[model samples]
Target: MAEFSVTLLIDASTSMTVTADTPEDAAELAMDEAGNPSLCHYCSGKMDVGDVYAARVYDGDKEVLDTDWTAQQLAAAEKQVEKLEKRVAELEQAEQDAVKVPRGLLECYLNGGGDWVEAGHKLRALLGGGE
Candidate 1:
């Protein structure tokens, strides 16, 4: 395998309980208390998260693939989020529509090789359910 350089970034957050006069003082106090994190029980929400952000492939000191994976991944994630949100909204609307549809109609629709989801939308439209 060719040697590749990869960069990953992690962001960690730890909650600390400290008594201080100002925000700066609190930060300082937190650091001072950080020596023994286990001693603090009141602290909460300790989290560490990271994502692979970049990679580089080199050929004899010449850079070949220098890519910002972070940008690409973020764009992809945004698109997925958009799609998921739309799907969730559709499902929720269908759930509401299901309440309006008669059981017989739903049974017939399903038995006729119609998916419940599409059936919900079409049935709702025919039933004069506004939006």
Candidate 2:
């Protein structure tokens, strides 16, 4: 979801780096690049040992070191989204209820010089008032 720039310390000696969407992606890229046996097979001499260590991870300007919280974060985000959706639905229902006056009553009220008391009686009657 976000781009990360990772600086890896290879075998505690050389610097191997990669930019990816996640820290896991960066680690996989570093491992694939450093641990490939084909390069050693092609060369006559023995290859140096390399172990990938993620030295630093950056998401834009902020530094991110903890890469194990993805599942927790996703669950939290899902809950927030669900809450927002329910709030939106409640707001929509409130809006609909606010404008639920009968169309004929509204037309008559608008045409009859805005009679507030008569419109109020009509609205109360439409809403099943005893009076």
Candidate 3:
């Protein structure tokens, strides 16, 4: 069966009364054997809303995957962000390098852009790929 998590919040005030199937079943079993149920009238009378409580039943913690797709996607996005930052720095430095040379040379280099070697190098360093 699939695992599931169920959180039940119960109010412990005078207006609310919480009952569980296990206790009710026990009471029924007592009634079947004896003339009266497992609980006495005094037991029911003493019951107060303060006895109410929140119960949680976690059915799927062990069977579920540790990391979901969203977590993987978030990690991928972090990598992409780092890569983009490096690319931006490379382009900025290239711009500074271009300023030192002739406009024509800079324009030519800009127009005929090569591979993303410079940006990739920087990103690789950021990602611990070494120098």
Using lDDT, give the best candidate's number: 2
Worst 10 residues of 3 by lDDT: 57-66
| TM-score for each candidate, following the candidate numbering | 0.30, 0.43, 0.29
Which is the winner by TM-score between candidate 1 and candidate 2?
2
- Where does candidate 3 clash, by residue pair? none
- The C-alpha RMSD in Å for every predicted model, in order, reads 18.6, 13.4, 17.8
Tens digits of per-residue lDDT, candidate 1, 1-131, equal: 79987655444445435566654465455555555333244433343334333333334465444355675687789999999999999999998867765874686488658877666666666767742
Q: How far is candidate 1 from the true structure (C-alpha RMSD, Å)?
A: 18.6
Clashes of each: 0, 0, 0
Residue 82 accuracy (lDDT) in model 1: 100
Name model 2 segments beyond 4 Å from true: 1-67, 101-105, 108-114
lDDT of 3 by residue, 1-131 (tens): 89997755434312112233553443344333443223357765654333222222222342211133565577799999999999999999999866644544444445546435554554445556765
Global local distance difference test of model 2:
0.63
**Native-to-model Cα distance after best TM-score fit, residue 27 in candidate 3, in Å:** 41
